[model samples]
Target: MAASAGPVLSREEVDRALARLGAERDAVESALLSLQDHPGLRLLDGADLTGRTQERWAVVGQGLPMLWALFDRYSEALASARAVRARKPRPGGPELAELSELLTGDAVTVPGGAPDGPQRLGAPARLVERVSLDGLMDRMNAWYATVLEVVSAADAVWTALPARIDLLIAELRRVQTLAASLGVRVGGHPLGDDLDALDADLGGLRTEVRSDPLALWRPARVPAQRGTVPDGGALATPSGVVDTERFDLAGRALDGVRLELENLLRLRDDAEERLQGVGDLLQRADATLAEARRARGEVLAKIAATEVPAVPGPASALRERIVVALELRQSGQWYRLAPLLDALEDAAAKELARARQSLTEVTQPLAVRAELRGRLDAYKAMAARLRVAEDPEVVERYEKARWLLWSAPCDLRAAAGAVARFQQALRPAPGGPDDGAATGPADLVDAVDAVDAADGTQQGGAWAGGEPADGQAVDGRVQGGRG
Candidate 1:
């Protein structure tokens, strides 16, 4: 993994760094002691020490020296323990009777060789010792590196302590002044009376440092309550303080105020805009109400002009009866009369819908007059077809049907049935009668002829009454009839 960038530590932050390193060193020391007392290492036996066994023993031996170094650096008591352990022998009787006999007087038996009593321990023994010693040296090197790092961090913190104290003092003072201006009181706080107490504390620190520069080096001498000081001495500076920490804090506080002010201003503007919209809506509503009143008057005039007789009482009473009949038809209860009623209902519905639409159009803005005109034109077009029917009977039947449909309290179903019958009778039968018999055209013509003949006879009799007398009469019949 790539190394992450470390925190940007000011001089004051460095002292905090040193304090953390000291704590870590103590934890490391504790870990080393635990390793030393591990039961497996203490139980090591010397029988059949193969290459793999040798490697394991070498690791323990190598680790011992580094452990010694770590103990030496971090704990005086542990260092003394390590020294005693180094001087001690393995936990068993000696493998050779005497050190001199094993080295010079005795010859060891050589493996896979004939009757040489014993061979001298030489290169293999030396190699085993070297491996163990190397492991011990590696561990020591690691401990040395760790101790150096801790010392470096501590020294750096000590060197920068004075400047860090100055910065912290300055920041505290600035915070104090602002808190006072805002009327904020840290009541009952152990850091004394708000910003004032903090300022005194910072001043005292600065005076202590000037007199004895080493005062800042000691962590215990520095006030533990420094963070609790409300404003310290930094906040008491003038409006344009050049210190970075104070300036940054003030900017943040002012930025929050600026945001709040902007939000309130935006809210006020939005409220004004909404108020204007409401006024426009009210004006439109008033205009619509006025138009509705005028249209209502026009509808009353139209109703009054209708020549059809009122069925009975108020128009509302008649309307109620129609509504009841419609409801019955719609409920599917009027099975026998349903077809005829349905036709009448359709016509009534169309007429009512048209009336309502007309009322709506009258109330609508004048800009919509074109739409109203188009609807009227469509209605007139529909009526024109009925007016110009070729058969007069058909035309009469249609007119009667329409009248029944629109008339209040009329027997709408019966009227629709009659109209349907008329329509059926008007249809010409194929190749049966092409003489317009359905319309009774021939009968109508004959009736007209008979009426004409009767009128002539009457005229002739009146003429005879005023004429000269015809004397001859035969069998009681007039001699000169109109024929």
Candidate 2:
């Protein structure tokens, strides 16, 4: 019997085991105390928790007392072994046997064996339940870990979401105040009914997050095997754990409201400037139309046998729309005024452009008649410069051309033809290059006819009154020139 027991543990081995067990008892005690002092645990204890955390905490709360009870039992068991081992420097076989049983055998008795209530209500239980030192430690570790996980997850949400929700709610109030000042309206309500609804809902959402923070708990994207507090909480970060979908929705809605308010405020600032721009455009358009009407009358009085496009009247409709838009802006109906001003500005710009175009078209006939008059005078000057001003054919053609040019309501085509004839009569006519290249008045008439035909129809060759270009000629004598 002595040999069997001595082989179980030598003196040094028995002392080593007691020291290790004592260290383990101290470690377990420290761990439990730290858990009790944990901020997450204290908050969970005080909070009126809701949802899954509420359900799980009820189970954890009951086990706390039993957990302490089990620790006391473990400590007592360690104390007995320590006392026996301390009795003498070298313990005898009976003392070693007792120490061995206390340390290694099933030494702690628990009344129900379960910290929780019995599994079956009416079922009979054993008279006694005994657990080894290792078994009790394992059970306590499991109970401690289970309780802390619930506490940590709940604390993670409480700490993160309510603060964010408060900030969002405060921002909503600012948006509301700014909207009121801007006179911003959406669909008959202030900032639309949704913003109001969100304002109200966000206040309630904050309360919901307080009571039911676990509902917002979600798994991390990478799903860490363990977490920060080491309670096996799996909340890699408190911020990462909250499912902020509602908070994010509220934020988006609030941002939209702020952005819209900013746009309306800018519109209010720029409204007068934009309206002034439109008014200036309308004034310019009206002035342009007046100028066009006067030009139309001048073209009719001064030019003959030419078509002039008539000017449309000033854009009265755009002016009326601008007036309505100004009234809407003054009344602070920015929603109505915004689109109206946009259309008004566009129409006013187009009206200004249209007025300018009308002025250009209306004066075109006068411009053409002036060009013909200038051409007739240029040819007459060329005749005088060439010293043929008094030749009878030249004089006759000049008188006819002068009659057409000087007369009001001139026939420009007949005048242009008469000028061409007079011009041809001034210049010596083309014959063969070897014939000293001169022909009489009938040939001059034929040359004028050729010029009128080419100018009126086909390209190439006119009476330039110069030597032919490219060694080519009109009837082998003249090169075409711009008149």
Candidate 3:
């Protein structure tokens, strides 16, 4: 509000002030027309507004007509001043003084309020007030800003929310179809429950958005100190924005649906791979069991050891479970089938492992006896190559070892010891009399003879059928003294 104490305007000064007021009038008219034509304002007019926007807009809407009425009055007063000045090329002192009073003083009349009307813009009757040109412009500007703020905020929500909601709804439909294929129904899965909730929330939100967009807006604050009323009331700041909470909730729900869909796809791939793995495991078990049965026959014929382990049959129960799981997958019972497949695969692998272990156990004694026979034959061939196969001690050890190794019900322990003795009879002494030129079989035979003559004296019981712990030859023959 301007103070009334200032120097009086001369004729020229009054003329200049009138020109400035005229410019201000032009600007105000243009601004008002712009506000009336604004797209946001148009949308607000058509929208079924609710909540805080509805309350604020009602007050703001009442004031809009008053803005134009005040502007018309301002134009009329300016036109009167201009006509009086035009009566002469330049106005006289009295005319200038009157114009100054009109520009500076309370010359504009706002109509009187009803006796029991609501205060502020809500009042139906025009409130009587007299304000200067500058004061009226300030009030108009403040009201303009307040109304524009609310209109723009609501328009923004309408523009942003509805289109986004539609897109999410489209995506939700696709997911629902996929969920149906996977047998993910509302009562069966938590994903279905979440989807149902999201559908309801989104449907309601879209309807609310289309109908009452302003209801979704959350203003940051009504800013204070824009301007003060003549009645000393502070003009509050404009409301800012649409609430983000609903938008955020909708986005999160869509994300949850997307994540679950991806999980279902991964489960589908895993289920197929595991099914194949189970089949391979069961097949391997059958092969291992067959091999074990064959090895049992071989062990009975070759190995003298009694009580060979029996081969286990393939696990038919686990195979049957795999068939059930496959049927479930084919029928699209994925949730029920997934765990069953896992259990089947694990059982099949264990069964295969058990069969392999049984086969190894059943064949092990035969394997040992075969190894002993191989060692006996290899030693005899080595003795023949050395030409010590006919040496009396070498021949005797070889014959006794052969009898134990080649005979039925062979004592593998005795056969192995006899073979070891023959091997010892063939090796030349480390530094004996025939240590020289020993590669030929005759020198090797003589080396054995020399080691036998020493007889636990020269070689520390290493050769010559060394006495057992009971001090007799192990084969129950005399230690052959060198001929």
Candidate 4:
């Protein structure tokens, strides 16, 4: 009995103990792998396992419970291996080296185990102690084959779970970026609530797995077979366990991605629609502006046509007469034809008035043109008014002035120029004599009164010349006498 007992272990026996555990893990792993190729071991049917395997028809129902137990045990061993790996001392440490040796080398005896004897698995009544490699391999292989079927069935569910999560994360980032660009919050229906839910579920699953990965080692209870221990529930069975919750999470993530993508597509569609409408509106506005410009051009053309022909004739005649009068006066001969000179001044004034009026009328269309000029000036003034103006009022006043200059009823400057021209034409010729006997003043006043009465009509027709009333030229040069 003493020889059968294993070597004793101490507090510092951690390395040796871990090494033994590793050997045991490896032994189980090898046995499970060998069993994969075994024959005559019937796969468990409905009685085999839980979760996904029970639905198959080829596996025997009687072998399911054992298979379930075998797989459960295998899961436990795998989880232990992961835990031990996590806790192993640093590389190059004696403990780590011991664990490595146990994993790849011969089994080590520890605590109560025999140093050179076969390892005792457990109490003889609890489990078979010296299972034949061939026999056990055959049994495990049959059981695992059924579990492999379960693994295949659950593959999409398991694999898709994490994939869905990854996709969800990517979509979430995309939505966040889009929301930022549009200057909107992310709390609305697009991906907000769904993302929140998925995040929470994923966090919970991660926490659960971190807390105890071995929790999955327990056999899953089938909804239909509540209390029965299926044969396939054995930990040593070759059943592949999948993280189903991960699949669920992934499904949700995929759903979120789909929804988010749909939202993005809709946003694009809406932007396109708005852009189309804006384009149409701009086209209409451009067309309207073009028509207005054409109309303005036509108006200006008419004014020019009316005023052009009359300009040269009257203006030139008046200038020539003024020059003649000035020359006569400078030669000290103006007293003889003082009345004629006065008449000339009056005629000159009338001609100037007409010229001015024609010019004013021709330029009236420019007020509309001036409107555009004023707007441009207003834009220029915007920078200067920042300091002097309290607000935009100065800018506005400047704009209004410009509008007045350009808009319909001609500007004050235009009207004033016309009046000034008329007044200038009424002035007595500079070299003419200022004698009381002259009817020049009276005739000129009457002419102005007539013009005033006619609402300042532009003079174009011949004037009524003042003479001796006997058909004699007042200045001895009668060449129609301004009539």
Which is the leading candidate under TM-score?
Answer: 2
Name model 2 segments beyond 4 Å from true: 1-7, 111-128, 185-190, 220-240, 374-403, 415-483
What does candidate 4's lDDT look like per residue over 209-284, in tens digits?
3332323332343211212113323233333354565646556665665565555445444543433343344344
Writing each residue's lDDT as its tens digit, candidate 3 over 84-165 gives 7777777777676667667776666655541121224455454577766666667666655556566667678887887888
**TM-score (C-alpha, index-matched) for candidate 2:** 0.76
Error of 3 at 193 (Å): 1.4
Q: How does model 3 score by TM-score?
A: 0.75
lDDT of 1 by residue, 1-483 (tens): 112133233333433433443344454555455444533333232223334334334333344444455334334422332343334343112222222122222112112211111121111322112111112223333433332222222233334444656665666655554444333345622222534554565565444433333222323321111111012111111111112343244335444533433443343334334333433443444444454456545434432222221111112433454555445434432322233334444544444444444435443322122222232233233334323254576567556655654444333233434444333333334444444333454443343334335433232232112221343211122221111
Ordered list by lDDT, greatest first? 3, 2, 4, 1
As for TM-score, the candidate ahead, 1 or 4, is: 4
Candidate 1 overall lDDT versus native:
0.35
Give the winner by TM-score: 1 or 2: 2
Residue 258 Cα positional deviation in candidate 1, in Å, after optimal superposition: 7.2
Looking at model 4, residue 259 earns an lDDT score of 61
- Candidate number that wins on lDDT, 1 or 2: 2
Q: Candidate 4, residue 234: CA error in Å?
A: 14
Question: Against the hidden reference, what TM-scores do the models get?
Answer: 0.23, 0.76, 0.75, 0.24
Model 2 Cα lDDT, one tens digit per residue, 159-223:
88878988988888788887777666445655666677887889888777777666777844322
